[model samples]
Target: MNDRTDAGGNPGPEQPGPEPTGPEHTGQPGQGAADGLARRAAAGFHRTEDGQVDVLRTVGGVRGLAESIVPGVVFLSAFTATQALNPSLVAALAVAAAFTVARLAQRTPLTQALAGLAGVVVCALVARSTGEAKDYYVPGFYTNAAYGTAMLLSIAVRWPFMGLVFGFIRGEGTHWRGDRRRQRAYAAATWAIVAVFAARLAVQLPLYFADQVQALGAARLVMGLPLYAMGLWLAWLISRPVAAAEGPRV
Candidate 1:
């Protein structure tokens, strides 16, 4: 015979080579599928051109300073302006409560709350050292103590509001960008601040004129306006398309 068998122990001509046993043949399709899923997830969280954390840090650094310093001054000035009002404790508590509520509603960051509390302590110490409390509050000891407590609470509550406001503003700018959209949003935010300042002035003028309160409203306005303006400028700068010279590192 020719040493070729079909149904016995001889190899058949139609039998193919052994199936692929390595990743190249077996795992390639699975790897391709996994890679596709990773790409989609990365695309969802990180902007194609910029990292998400980097953007948040940059915006937060700039906006945090603006929000903290400006709002701090405004709140302090408001307290000073209302010093002569009856039930000073009530006024102070009300201001503190408003800030606290706003902050809680917005879920502000913890760092912001601590910073605000520090500011309040500083204000209280300043008021006590300056002898303003002695001058304004009759039976000066008790009144000063009451005022100090109120100031402390007001300061304590500010941190939350600062976090909320800054976060909202930064988030809005981060998630949307168009020259016109940014410009309009910037204008609107600025105008809203202006309106609040204006309303405060209107309410405060009578008290100022009657000599019942100091002219601290102007100081408050001055302190807050620059911050809002600077924030707008910063937003504009960040929103600009990265220059060709800088080349994608941004």
Candidate 2:
């Protein structure tokens, strides 16, 4: 009369009760997928064996830094010195293309270099079409705004983006969400990123509107990698878990 049956319809012993499910259980819905994503995100960072994050590595090291900053520098310098949009665009685009080609020649991953090239191309195209050097920075403004808005939204949902990433980095996983202090700390960290984006907009938008290509480009350089590096470092610092206070040494 037992309902449990084997594949051949033979009577079978009662199956074990459903194993408890969660991050610890293989049957937990999405647990494996989430952990996989977390691992990949952590891998993207350059972490020391002890799990300390290297900011330089996160920004893609020296070559990566050059890839991100050089094209903009080329464009700005070329335009500022010559006051010619066509030549400046060409110079910038050439530098970006050179990076992609070099990565290809080295047989390295093309994701970052290709992306940088694409952005440079888009900016150059926008500037070329509009015939305004300032338009070169137009795409940047919207990009910052969009990122800032997305991070802000993540905080509003109580699932901070940095927390999600840092949680895995620190091996706390999503369990950090249950700790009020950790949650608040990560919220602050996420806010640091939002602030970076906001600062860029606040400083560069006015420059854009005023048609100050040289000043805008200069501001962009100052605020681009260096500012972002500082912000990321600050976030990492802010989100570090505080050690428990020692009790009286009895």
Model 2, range 22-51, lDDT digits (tens) per residue?
443343466666656555545554455654
Query: In model 1, where do residues sit more than 4 Å from their true spots?
Result: 1-90, 101-108, 133-213, 225-242, 245-249
lDDT per residue for candidate 1 within 57-125, as digits (tens), equals 322344333433443344445557665423343333344345545657788653433343333344444
Give the residue spans of candidate 2 off by over 4 A. Answer: 1-30, 40-43, 245-250
Instruction: Please give the RMSD of candidate 1 to the true structure.
Output: 26.7
Q: Return the top candidate by lDDT.
A: 2
Worst 10 residues of 1 by lDDT: 1-10
